[model samples]
Target: MGIVINQSIKNTIITYIGFAIGALNTLFMYVQFLGDTYYGLVGYILSAANIMMPLMAFGVHNTLVKFYNEFETEKQKSQFLTFILFLPFILIIPFSLIGYFGYHQIASLLSKKNFIVYDYVWQIPVIALCMGYFEIFYAWVKVHLQSVFGNFIKEVFLRILITISLLAVYYNFITPIQFVFALMGIYLTMTIIMKLYALRVKMPSFQLVIPKNVKAIIWYCIFIILSGSVANLLLEIDKFMLNFYIKIENIAYYSVAIFIATVIAVPSRAMHQITYPITAKLMSENKHDDLNNLYKKTSITLQIIGGLIFIGIILNIHELYKIMPADYSEGIFVVFVIGLSKYFDLILGNNNAIIFNSKYFSAVLILGLLLIGVTISLNIVFIPKFGIKGAAFATLISITLYSLSKLLFVVFKMKLYPFTIATLKSFALLIVTFVLFYFWDFGFNPVLNIVLKSILITAFYLGLSYYLKLSSDINYIINSVFKKIRN
Candidate 1:
């Protein structure tokens, strides 16, 4: 528990640093420097890269994490790592060539506007290749239980690069097209840096001897590819579908709101990086009781933290919109729907980690595929009607169903539920804190109002947590935090 708390605190700091950079880019630079259409194009390009990343990597990233423990020897681990590294190239190279040759036809089918998507089309493969290896190497580092550095590279370094790129765009040093290319360059460079860091830890050595479980590893990668695709689809499919149904400009607006809403999930994301490997290690040792306890604590802690972020955003959403251009302001509702989806995800705790690392992972993937089908169906039906808002609605519904399905599976199949009396108490505290902060009129100065209201809301939430005894974890965190401050 202390280790989790310590890592969580470190991750929180890194997340906030990333968030600050992200806030600057999204709220200030993006709005002021890029117009809606250009911004949306950037959004689409990134979303497309993310959508293709899993398939391009052939699930090697996840394969690394899942099978790292299976290799008992240094030579065995090296052989497996070597195979995973080269496997993605086999798929990505041909796909890139195909995309290059079929650029126009693909663009025609994807968009009505005769935009220069072709120039950027090849970047999809490049971004995918870079992002693919980044995840693989990141997982390699995680196997060593050194997640904070990887998280820093991912959450902090990437955003910092994007911020600099946005600044260049703001200064008119790069056109929109060039900016897109610059974004691709940033991803590629970041991947290189990540690789270097991983090498510093332990350079991956290629061994000629093949492991006996090669067939099993291949099957695991195949299953993981499908599972990873479904997961990415839940998050990125809406952006892709939005491109088909609406203009590129609308995507920019939707992306901003989604960004804000998704920030609530940062704690979950940060903790997951550290927790997944830990969970995997525990499961490998058949430590179900410890796993279950960790699951509950993570769920309650993340929900409490995520819920506060959700409420803070919801309460001050209007003020936030005022900072952005008028067109982007329409995405306020998208923020709410997506924020709720993230909150629900937090409440599910480490249900995903548990399922993904467990013996019944295939069953989990099958359920995920069903949910992806439902998500796609909902988006197709609703996107044309509601535009970006409808897309948000579809995402919210899909993620809600996805989280609930996982929770139920964990409870019924594994007989592991992540809820406790503390969960209920945390919910009550969240409600009371939100209601109190909701009624306060913070006046017209957006910056001051945001800061002042945030402080009060945080105080109320923590005060309520202390008073209600939400969890010993929370009480311990409070004491530790104060102790550190005092020291």
Candidate 2:
């Protein structure tokens, strides 16, 4: 718990700083510098690449984390690492061949609604390869329980580079198209840095000896391709599909709203950096009691923090929108719907880690596939009728159903639940705080109003949470901070 909190706090602070930079880019820089069309174009290309990343990596990223501790001898571990390292080429080689032979056809298919996407289609696979390898090496460090550097690279490095690229665009140093090209270089640079850092942490001996469980390793990688595909698809598919239905510029609007709502996820994202490997370790060791305790602690802690973020976003969403371009203001409903969905996901804590490492992962894969089908169907039906907001509804419905299925599977199959009496208290507090704060605001600039409202909300929520002792872990941290202050 000490290490988890320590790293989680570091990861959280780092992640929030990254989001702040990203928010500046997404909310202001991209729109002002690139215009709506190129902004949407960049969004679509990246979303498409993200959807392709898991398949490109061949699931080696996940497999490494799940099975790293299985081998006893250093020789065996080296063989294991060497094996997963080359595993991605199984798919990468074939994917590259298909791209070479069928580039125009692929581009034509993707650009059915928006012809601008045709030229950029080649960038998707190139960027996906970068993203895939980045995650692969990131998992490499995580198995070593050294995630803070990887977290920084993953969260902060790329955004900072993008900021530089955007500045270049503003000063006439590069065209928007060049900026997009520069993005490809940026991703490649980041991946190379991560690979270097991972090697420094633990260089594989490059032993070619295959582990005895080669069959299981291949099977898990195959399963992860499917599972990771569904998961990434669930998040990014809406943006990709939007390219097929609405105008490309609408994606820029949608992306802004989604970015604002995504801040609610920062805490979960930060905690998962460390908790995932820890959860995998616990499940591998068969420490059911510790795993359950960690699950509940993470759930309430994230709920407490994530709930505050959610309230703050919804309460200040109007003011936040006012600061954005008026054309993007229509996404207010999108923010609310997506914000609620992310908050729900945050409270699930390490549920994803539990499932992915458990025996029932295959079952959840089937459920996920079905839910993605439902998501696509809902998107098809809704987007034509309701526009961008329709995509939000589709996502909300699909994610809610998917999340509930995962929760129930864990409860019935593993006899573990993430909620407790503390969960209910946290929920009640979230509701009360939102009601009290939602209807009022300081009559200041949008930025100032957000700051003032956030302070009040943080003070009120954390003060009451401390009084109620909702989480001893959180209370202890509060006390520790106060003690340091007095000293």
TM-score leader: 2
lDDT of 1 at 381: 95
Top lDDT hit: 2
Q: Scored by CA lDDT, what does every candidate get?
A: 0.84, 0.93
Task: Candidate 1: list runs displaced more than 4 Å.
Answer: none
Steric clash pairs (candidate 2)? none
lDDT of 1 by residue, 354-414 (tens): 8888878898788889999999999999999989999999999999988888888899998
**What C-alpha lDDT does candidate 1 achieve relative to the native structure?**
0.84
Q: How do the residues 1-487 of candidate 2 rate in per-residue lDDT, one tens digit apiece?
A: 9989999989999999999999999999998999999999999999999999999899999899999999887778888988888889998999999999999999999999999999999999999999999999999999998999988987898999999999999999999999999999999999999999999998878887778899989999998999999989889989999999999999999999999999999999999999999999999999999999999999999999898899988888899888888999989999999998898988898999999999889999999999999999999999989889999999999988989899999999999989999889999999999889878878789899999988999999999999999987789889999999999
Worst 10 residues of 1 by lDDT: 110-119
Per-prediction TM-score: 0.97, 0.99
Per-prediction RMSD in angstroms?
Answer: 1.5, 0.9
- Give the Å shift of residue 255 in candidate 2: 0.7
